[model samples]
Target: MATYKKRGYKPKKEKVVEEAIEETFDESQSDVAKAFDGLDEAANKSEQWIEKNSRPLFYGLVAIAGLILAYLLYTKFIAEPTEIEASNELAYPRTFFDQAETAAGVKADSLYTLGLEGGDGKYGFLDIASTFSGTKAGNIANYYAGISYLKMKNYKEAIEYLSKFSSDDELLGPTALGAIGDAFADINQPKDALDYYEKAANKQANDFTTPLFLFKAGQTAMQLNEFSKAESLFTQIKDNYATTQIGRNIDKYINSAKYAQ
Candidate 1:
């Protein structure tokens, strides 16, 4: 009770600390205003740099556009027309090839020679393949060239031309594949030869060529000591083309394969 009569109020120190904090905040606001002004100046400089460099950038873009247009025009106007002209020039060689197919011995040889010789000029077979590579006749000439090369026993050249010749005709396509097998066989690459013969046999599957190639493939497999493969091929001919000449001869190969095994 005696202490309560003398009690009096006292101000807290926290109000002074709050006043100091408010003063620091006021100073920090001025610094923030100065930083924003510096950012505005940097933005102005960036705009100036872009404006100064825009003309060169636009010129570079225009030059690239012009190069693309020139290339397209050159391909369309110059390259395509030249190809058409070259294809027209290959007509005679094609005629000679057709004639050679029906002619016999010396006459066929002469026509084939003429075809090869005539295909040599500026618009010749070689030129047509090189220049008018898009034409059908050019491609046909390549096939003829390969066949001629094969007959001449120029196996390497035959392979080159035949590799380039592509067709969907059932007879010619398998025949060409068979010729490649023959060329490989001539060079004594038996494994590669066997592969191509099998490919030829399976490609078109005609009674004329398929059984013949299958027989050849079986023979090649026998040469390579692959008795099981040879037996399989022979058995396929026996089962699939039993009336064909190769089919009739299949039993001999089957026996030979079994003997080798």
Candidate 2:
């Protein structure tokens, strides 16, 4: 038996493998090309949309800029100048108010009247409070007017002006509240007096106003026959404000409230 060999024979398996690798490379190239085409289409759409809305975008930006400019102009020209003018106007009334605090009886009353009503072509606290309503000096005018009314024994007007005044100041805020309490007490409203005294005490925790108002609140509570509340307030003074003059003398008040209870 004999076997015959054919010359120049090539394997078809290697050719099939080479053809598959070429096909895979072509498919990868096609995918990359499709991705680039998609990106280009998206960019063209974005540019078209921006072009269509460009006028509206520009107008919106311009409107925003206009508002900012208006605010700046108003703050610089109108508001700042008004504030300065209001402050200058407040000085005249303030002098009368300060002098009234130290003067006696008729002299004090005359100064207070001058402070409230104005003289020598200058504005008074009442006018400043009304005319410059939103200014800092105007706010201070309200406080001055309220105290003037209180000193003049005009309890109703005192309550009105003091109630209108608002502040977050450590000293002034509590003092205003305490002054309201004083007005209420003078008008024979012990309950309202106690309430405002409590408010004043809790408005801000400081050495001067806190113990002062707390002592007043305790006394007012005693007047209303709220002995337990009075005792509690006195106890707070003892615990927190022992260095204060009122706090040093708080024990007697505490004992009185407890005994009453």
Candidate 3:
């Protein structure tokens, strides 16, 4: 009994368990390495894309910044200054006109002429209108010019200046339209007068100017021998605008229109 017994084979369960543990450890290491490699590849692709497209993106950003800067400069420096200048320039003409309203005969006419033509080298309504056609003061100049020309009995000039004037002013807008109709009537263009008179009546729908224009329209329609149209206009004054100055005397015109019809 001198020699040690020879070693025997291990149990099957123990051998299988040890081999599975070794295999699992090896596979886990391989999966981790593959995941790290994928991450490195994605990072490289992102860097390449950024490098390729960076120039255009930078240029686009610069363009947007420049546009914003230019807009700010124009608004502050050019647009605002021009608007202020236009407003200031209107004072000379407006003052001359105010004085002309109270002046009598030759002096009144002279003041109006000065307002239209400018005095002492100062700008007049006509000059302002031509210089600052896009501004509020310039637009008002056209209205003033129109009325001045109307008072001067220059019907063509009245039409020219009035047609150029535009505003949302509640009183002036209707007045300009009615004045145009008056010019047409003075020129013996009854059809044109009637059309503009009707426009004035409907434009702002106020008590004062509406009845006045309606009266003018009725008169123009009668001049055109359109008795039916005249009758309707007078009836409108009687029914809806019976309190105005024109409405007070509207009954006779209504009766006249009815007789003509």
Better of 1 and 3 by lDDT: 3
Error of 3 at 117 (Å): 1.1
What is residue 182's positional error in candidate 2, in angstroms? 0.7
lDDT of each: 0.83, 0.95, 0.90
Better-scoring candidate (lDDT), 1 or 2: 2
lDDT of 3 by residue, 46-92 (tens): 98998999999899999999999999999899878987998898898
lDDT of 3 at 132: 89
Q: Cα RMSDs of all predictions?
A: 8.4, 4.9, 10.0
- Cα lDDT tens digits, model 1, 92-190, are 776776788788777887777676667444344555666566667678767888887676577998889888988888898988989999999999999
> Which of 1 and 3 is the better model by TM-score?
3
* Native-to-model Cα distance after best TM-score fit, residue 211 in candidate 2, in Å: 0.2
lDDT of 3 at 57: 85
Looking at model 2, which ten-residue stretch has the lowest summed lDDT? Answer: 3-12
Model 1 steric clash total = 2
Question: Per-residue lDDT for 1-261 in model 2, tens only?
Answer: 998767865579988998899999999999999999999999999999999999999999999999999999999999999999999999999999999999989999999999999998999999999999999999989999999999999999999999989999999999999999999999999999999999999999999999999999999989989999999999999999998888898999999999998
Error of 2 at 239 (Å): 0.2
Off by over 4 Å in 2: 1-49
